[model samples]
Target: MREVAIIGAGMTKFGRSDLSLIEIMSEAAIRALEDAALGDQKVDSVYVANMGAARLNRQTAIASALVDQLNLFPAMAEAVENGPASGASAFKNGFQAIASGMADVVLVTGGERMREVNNLEATDFVASMSHPQAEYIYGVTLPALAGMFTRLYMDRYGVTAKHLALVAIKNHANALKNPYAHIHQAITIEGILTAPEAVVNNPYIADPLRLYDCCPVSDGAAALVLTTREIAEKLGKPIVKVGGIGQATDTHAVHERPDPTELTAVKIAAQKAFQMAGIGPQDIDVAELHDAFTILEIAESEEAGFFPKGEGHNALEQGVTSLGGKLPINPSGGLKAKGHPVGATGVAQLVELTWQLRGAAGDRQVEGAKNAFACNFGGFGNNVVTTVLMREE
Candidate 1:
């Protein structure tokens, strides 16, 4: 297979958006195309990733609408949905399109306008990803699952609410440097957990998970332009090769997993990506873990091989995952502060890493970053897609 590299990346601010889903996606795509300096060149294919436009916005065939909106009529258009992993799944498809010699230039864009519906309805729409008989039938929301997972993790790993708060504080601070992050407000342990008004300020959403522990429901889009290495070199852009991509799935229901606290899919998928990239977790300079909840940051860090199984919280307390640390995680604030726009999240993670690799991430940039990693968790860790990206010298 031919090598595939990302030539351009762009994203919309992660928050409530007035623009329609197609329009949001088009905006990100146009920015990416312009970044690639396509100069009127036609794209060979366009892949759109989204989770709930049909359910929330009452729209379908979004890929075709985006093609028309962008005037890319003849381009092969398709929509991909893989729960919350939709963005990365679409990206994998686009990568295969180029690597398999079927297409030269591919546009992969992901967007979700989840705020169009009420908060409760939006939550239910996302909850549809759960198992039909085991999870969704009983109304097992994502937060409830996360809360239980957090409680179990705390028991096994000695992670406390303070450690979770550290994740929130660190990511929130990083988001302040990210112009596109959803929550710009800076938080502190005192404000969220320790202060007298903490109870009212950050009330419990689930038993152990509080309001601040969960990612906000957001509307946003992100896009990337991928091409052959030869084309990337000719474009005179920074070559950020798709070094490796790996995906894995666990049981349909989280309860079916052998160990509920262990993210087996994340571990297996990350190992595949690292092996394919000819590297290991130690070689990753920066990472973007799907931190939909604060506990996930700790759990995924361990599962992705960045920390020991039960010591991820220790790494957190030691400042190892901070921005200036040896391995800064989530320089773009992750799903915690960046907002979780389900469909857009996976693509957004890559967009952030592309910028990190290119040294273009303004304030949140990780200095001298050469290799980056990202994990896009789906369906409570039942499905995951892991990626490795390297900057070519």
Candidate 2:
């Protein structure tokens, strides 16, 4: 396969935006073009990774629609939706195009505008990601399922509620320095712990999980301009190479899993990515983990081999995952602090890692960042995609 490099990465500020889906995605695409120092005329293909423009905005075929809106209508355009991993799926496609010599430069983008719906409507919309018969029909929202799993994790791993709050505190602190992050409020353990006492404080969502523990519904988009290593050299831009990629799937219904604590897909995908990159977890200088919930960040750190099993909480408690810690995770504020707009999440992971590897992340930058890793799990670990990227200078 030909070497693939990310010539540019660009994303919209992930928050409640008044912009429509097309507008948000196009804005990102335009920025990506500028970052790559290329004009719209240079793009060869377009791959979009949005899940719910139809349900959220009554618009569909957003991939082709984006092409026309960006005046790249003649280029090949395709949409990929692997639930929340949709953005990573799009990136995989763009990588294949470059590796196969099918395209020299491709615009890989994903976005979602979800604030238009009320909270209840938004919850119901997100539920559509799982199996209709076994999952969604039971009125299982993502947080409800995650809360159940969190209960299991706590029981099995001896994790405490305080441990989970550490994840939130760390990400929120990191987001404070990220201007593009959705929620930039720096939180304290005392604030989260005491806020849930009164009705105005941290309200309980599902059992064992409160509002602060959950990610906010957001409207956001992120894009990357991908090209071959040769093309990158020709453009004379910083080259962030795609060193490795791995994707795997698991049973969609959470109840059907043999071991709920073991996200088999995540372990397998991360293993493959590490093997392909010829590196271990220790080689990951910086990481952007999928933190859809506070517990997820903890679980994923262990699953990805960044920390030992049953000790993920310990890593966070020791400030090991903080911005200046031994290993920095989610310096972009992650999905928890940055917001989870479903389909846009995975792309945002890569966007953050690209900036980190390029040393462009100002305040939240990991010191001496060289190799970066990202793990994007879709549908509560049912579908997992792990990517390992490197600075190819």
Candidate 3:
């Protein structure tokens, strides 16, 4: 079709916000709109992504509320819900709107006010995305699923708890440099894993996956202003093009998968995205995988072709995924420390990549980075949205 470019990206600090969901999203929208400086141009439409405002916040019609609150009268407004991948799903919709010649400019915003509910309620709400009869009826939460996956992956690949701890330590250190990151507390290996009080400190939520291994329950919002290349030229900023978008799905039940350790959807989605971008995993300078759990970063890296099968943790051990490594992964602190507001996370990945390409990521910047990739995993790999973005100087 046509080329689409992100002109601006903005996100609120990902933490417990007392702001209403609409207010949070609108704030981010206004910031992104200002960043784009779309002087006389009108916003053709708005797509809001969220997962639990209806159930947790007792609200609905979030997109309508956002557009109205921002005073974007008469613009088309629609809400998208695709579990945790909701952000990328909504972003894909915006890309289609611009690329198909339907809209000149689209505002894509994803948000969640998850802190409105207690931790137990939040976990249950996210668990609702699982298969109703097969998973939810049996009370399967995401952490328990991830824990099981981690154990199986370890058995197959020889990954250990120490490697998992290394992931947490690295991401937490990265988060200290990110002002927008939710968890600013620096965690040491001794404190979390090696200390005598480690059990009390990093207690296991599920076997082999402790509290520190999990992303926190957070509330936040992120937004992007996307337009065609022609519009981007007038915006007078460096252009970060949406090179390719790919999405895929797998079996709904974790037990039904042919190989429990393999993330087939991640592999398929990454392949489609790379083919569309006309690049392979080797071409990516930086990446942000859906590290809601530390093991996911390692698993997704392998499935996304960044490493040989069952060798992702080896790369981690070699420092290949660190900030100054050959290919930096999750330089934005990832969902591990940056926080996973479910709906907000996918868009936040794009926001971080846009900043990295623009040379504005500050302390977490990947020097000379040009091509970046993001994978937003949803519902234990049942659904995934992968994106490849390129900077055109």
Candidates in order, TM-scores: namely 0.99, 0.97, 0.99
Which one wins by TM-score: 2 or 3? 3
Q: Clashes in each model (backbone N, CA, C under 3 Å)?
A: 0, 3, 0
Q: Tell me model 1's lDDT, rounded to 2 decimals.
A: 0.94
Model-by-model lDDT, in order?
Answer: 0.94, 0.89, 0.94
Taking the tens digit of each residue's C-alpha lDDT, what string does model 2 give over 335-376? 988988887888889999999999999998897898999999
Local error of candidate 1 at 279, Å? 0.6
**Tens digit of per-residue lDDT, candidate 1, span 1-393:** 999999989999999999999999999998899899976557999999999999999999999999999999799999999989999999999999999999999999999999999999988888888888999989899998999999999998899999999999999999999999999999989999999999999999998999999999999999999999999888788899999999999998999988999899999999999998999999999999999999999999999999989999999999999999989999999999999899999999999999999999999899999999999999999889999999989
Q: On lDDT, who's better, 1 or 2? A: 1
> In model 3, which residue pairs have backbone atoms overlapping below 3 Å?
none
Residues 19-90 of candidate 3: C-alpha lDDT, one tens digit per residue: 999988988888899898999999998999999999999999999999989999888989999999999999
The C-alpha stretches of model 1 lying farther than 4 A from their native spots are none
Supply the TM-score for candidate 3: 0.99
Could you tell me how far off, in angstroms, the CA of residue 306 lies in candidate 2 after the best superposition? 0.9
Kindly report which residue stretches of model 3 are placed more than 4 angstroms away from their true locations once superposed.
none
Give the distance in Å from residue 348's predicted Cα in candidate 2 to where it truly belongs. 1.0
Worst 10 residues of 2 by lDDT: 194-203
